[model samples]
Target: MIDAEGLSIKIGAEAKEFDGEARFSRSQLTLWDRVTQMAIAAGEEAVQSAGLELGDEESLRAGAVVGTSMGGMHTLDENYDLIYRQGKSRIHPFTVPKLMPNAPASHLSMAFGARGPSWAVTTACASSNHAMGQAFQMVRSGALDVAITGGCESQLTFGVLKAWEGLRGMARDACRPFSKNRTGMVQGEGAAIIIFEKLERAIARGAPIWAEVVGFGASSDANDIVQPNQDGASRAMRAALQDAGLGAGEIGYINAHGTATAANDRTECAAIRHVFGEHADGLMVSSTKSMHGHCIGAAGALEMVATLGALRDGVIPPTINYDEPDPDCDLDVVPNEAREVEIEAALSNSFAFGGLNAVVAMRKWRGA
Candidate 1:
C-alpha cells in the first residue's frame, strides 16, 4: 500500500497565535493566497523532511494536489478597486492565474518541479480531504512513486467576511466549540501539506514514516448546501472504519468536525454517538478550530497534520476557549493545553457544506 509519510504544516507568513485572539500583522493577500503560501512552506518542509532535492529531474514521477475553498477573492477585490474607483481599462494578466483556485497546486508543482500530475480538488470544506484522498489512490494505484498533497485557504477577505456575515452562523466574538456558550466559527486562514509514498518504497528509501493512511471514506449528503446531515456523516465514518478494517472501539481518538456552529456541533456529536455508541465516549475527541478558528478548505489537512503531530509528539493540541461544555457534545475534548496519551490509531473528520463528508484514518507508522 502507498503510505503517507511526512506530514508538515506552515502557518501563513502572517502568523496568528493559536488562540483566535487577534491579528499579529496587517494581512496583505486575500486569506486564501496567504494560506497558499502556508502550503508552499509546508511542502518545502516536507521535502526537507523526506531528504529529497527539489527540481530534481528524478522527481518527475512526483505529483501534487492542493485544495482551496475561495480562491483569489483578495485579488478580485483589489481588481474591482482598480476598475471601479481608479477607472482602469483592463485587469492585470496575472489576475486569472493568481485568483484561480488551482493556483496553489500550480505553484506547488512549479516550485517542486513535480511533473507527473497536478490538480486542485474543490468540494467546499471537503476540498483538501478530497484532494488528499485522490493523491492516496494515485499512490496506491502506482501512478506515482510519491505525491505531495494538502490544502490551503484564506477566506478572511472583506468580500469573504461580508459573505460569511450573511451566513449569520459565525460567532460575534470568540469561537467556542462544543461549549454551551459557543456561538459559531470564527474565520481562519492557513495551509498544510503532507507527503505520501508507497510503504515499501518509503522503507526502501529509509524515509521517516510519520503516519500510515489505512483508510479513507467520502460521501455526499445530497440534502442541503449549507446544513450538515448526521446520517450522511455517520455513514462516511462507518465506511472509513470498515476500510481501515477497524471497529469503532479500535479508534482511540477522533479529530472531530466540530465547527462550533450550533447545528454542526450538535449534529456531528449525534453522528459520532450514533456510529460509535458507548465507545464514542471512550475516544478522545477535540476540535483544534477552537485555537485556529475555522480555516475553511485547509481545515481538514491542518487537522490531519495535527493528528500526525499528536502521534509524533504524543501530545494532543487542546481545544482552547472551551469553557462551558455542551451536553450534546459530551465527550472528552482534550480542553485547553496539550495532553499526553497513546494514540495508536486516530481519525480526522471533515463535513463540508453541500453535505460533503470525508473521513480519513491514520495509524502511527510502526516499522513492521
Candidate 2:
C-alpha cells in the first residue's frame, strides 16, 4: 500500500524517498525534479528487466514516453513558496527545465540513449494509459524496437493537497471502493514503468514475456469536465475488444478504474455492464486503489503492472477495504482479500476526470 499516515495531508499514500543512497550522482540529482528522478528510476528498471543493452545505432530507434499530470509539482511549489511567501526576488535558474511536462520523458530518453519518438502525455488520470498505448502502437508499427513507457507523479505538496480538499474528494476514512460505506478518494504518489518490444524481437532475444499487449482503446467524452460518462467508457472498451479481436467472454478479469468515489464506481460498473452484457456477471473485477490509493496520473501504469502481475502469478489482488456492498457497483470486487485465479485475458481501464478514457487488453504470456 502506498498511502499511509505521516504525509502532509490528513491521509495519503506517498512514495518514500530512496531507501538506500540516491539513484543518481549528487551532481546529477541537483538538476532533476522528483518527477524526472522517478521516471529515470522506473525507466532504467524496465530497460534492465527487458535485458536490453542497445548499441549506438540501435538506440536511435529505442524511445520513451512517460506521463505526468502534475509535472514538477515539488519544484514549482517550492519555488513559489520561496518567491511569494519568503518575499524573494530571485528564483532558481533551472525552474523552467524542471517544470516542463516533457522533462521526465526527456530524462528517460537521455538515460537510455534512446533517440526515437520520446514524449509525454498529461491526460489527468489516464495519462499513463495513453502514453503506454502510443508506445504499443509504435512497436506494432515498427517505428521502434524497444520503448520505455509508464508514468510518475509526486503531487503530495501542501498546496496540492489543500486544492484537492477543496474539491471534496478526500476520504475521511479509508478508500473503500465499490462499498456502501465509501466516503471518497485518497491521494497517492509513485511511478510504474513497463518495457515494450516487438514480439519477434523478444522471442529472438529469449526475453521473458510477462504478458502480451493485444490492443488499446481510447475515447473522449466531450461532456462534463469532472463527471464521467458511461457511453464514452463503453465505446473505449468496445474499441479495445475489436482491436484485440477478442470476444467479451475471453476476458476473465478486469483491473477497474475504481476510485472509491460514489460516481466512479457506479459509472464504471454501468460501462462494464453495457460493454460485456451477461459476461459482466461472471467477470472478476477489483480495485487495487483500496490498497494503494489513487495515484492520479500514475494510476493507470501502477494498475497495469498489478494486472499483469496477477496474470503472471495467477493471484488477483483484492479490494482491501470493502466493508459493505453498494448495489450500484455490484461487481465481484474480490473484496478484502487476494484470490488465486488463472486469467487468460484481462483489461485494465483508466478513466480520467476530464471524461477521457483509455483501456488496454492483455493476455497471459506462454512460451514462444
Candidate 3:
C-alpha cells in the first residue's frame, strides 16, 4: 500500500484521525462544510504544483469539477441532529449552502477563478474518475486551457459510520486486499485535486509534466446494484486501452479497484485476466486501499495520483496487509513491500458499487 502516513480504519469507532480544526481556519471550519474545506485545501496544493495562479490569465479559461459520493454528509447530519435531538428551532444560518453537494466545486471555482465550468459528480466511487475524464476531455478539445479536477469525501460521521457498519463491509481492523484471510473493506476520508492542462500549453509554459492521462473509459453494468460484473469491468479496461491507442501488452501496472472484499478482489483480478489475456501474469497489480482505506468518492483520484507516482518514480506501491493470497486473485499483487521497476504505463481502475466502472490509462511522460 502507498504509505498513508497514519491513516487508520475507523469503521466502528470515531474518525479521530481527521483533525478538522487543525487543517482549516476557524472561519472556514465553522462556516464551510468539511468536504468543501478539503476541496479547497486540495485545490490550493494542486494549483501550487502546476505553478498556476488560476484566473490570473487562465482564470476565465480554467474550470473545476470536483466529485464526491456523499457530499457534506457531516453538515446534513449535524443540522438534522440539532433540530430533532436538541429540540432546536434555529439551525446554522448557512445550512443549505453548507451541505450542498456542489459546494466544493463552487468554492474551488471562487478560490481559484475557475469560471469556465464548475460542477460536481456524485457517482459513488467512480465520481472522481468521471470528473477527471470530463476535465481531460475539455483540455484535449481546447474547451479549457486548465482544469482543477478531482474529488473529496468526508463520510466518517456517526450516521455514515453506522450505515457502513450496517452494510457489513467494515473490516475488523486493517484492510487486507486480495488476502485469503481478508475480512472486509474499511472507510477513509480525504480529497485529491489534480491539475489538468493541454499538452501544448504545458509544453509552451515548460511546466513539469507529471504523467500523461492518455485515455479514460467508462461503462455501466446495468445488472446488479452492488455486485460487480466481470464482463462490464473488462469492457471498461479494453475501452481505456483503445482510447489511449495502446494494446494490452503495453500495460505494466494496474492500480486495481481492490476493495479487499471477497467479491471485489476476485472479480477485478478475473476481469483483468480476461482483458489482458497472457499479459496478465507479467503485470504488477496492487491496491493501496489496504493502507488508506476506501476513501469512497475520493478513491479514484487518490489512486490516480498514486499510479502517477508509480509512473514517475519507477516504483510500484504494494498492497499492504496482504498475507495469504487468494487463488482467485492470483495475479502478482506486489505483496506487502514496495518494488522498484521501470514501468512505462499503468491503469487506475475504479469499479463503483453500482457497477459503474471507470478506468484510466496513463503512460510515463518521456517528453514529446
Q: Name the best candidate (by lDDT).
A: 2
Per-residue alpha-carbon lDDT of candidate 1 for residues 64-132, written as tens digits (9 for 90 to 100): 988788876667777887899899999877777778888888878877889889898888888888888
The residue-by-residue lDDT of candidate 3 on 1-368, one tens digit each, is: 11233334354312355566888888787767888887888888888888876546678788898889988898998888899999999987888888888999998988887888788988898899989988888888888888899999888776677677677776877789999999888888888999998898888888888999999999999999899899989999999999999889999999999998889999999999999999999999999998777888898998998999999999899999998978999999999999999898999999998989999899999988
| Every model: Cα RMSD to truth | 7.5, 2.3, 3.7
**lDDT values for all models:** 0.80, 0.87, 0.87
Candidate 2, superposed: residue stretches over 4 Å from native: 1-9, 17-21
TM-score of each: 0.89, 0.96, 0.94
Query: How do the residues 146-208 of candidate 2 rate in per-residue lDDT, one tens digit apiece?
Result: 888989888888777878877887788789999999988989888888988899988998897
lDDT for model 2, on a 0 to 1 scale? 0.87
Model 1 Cα RMSD, 1 decimal = 7.5
Q: How many angstroms is residue 321 displaced in model 1 relative to the true structure, after the best TM-score fit?
A: 0.6
* Selected candidate, larger lDDT, 2 vs 3: 2
Show where candidate 3 strays beyond 4 Å.
1-18, 55-57
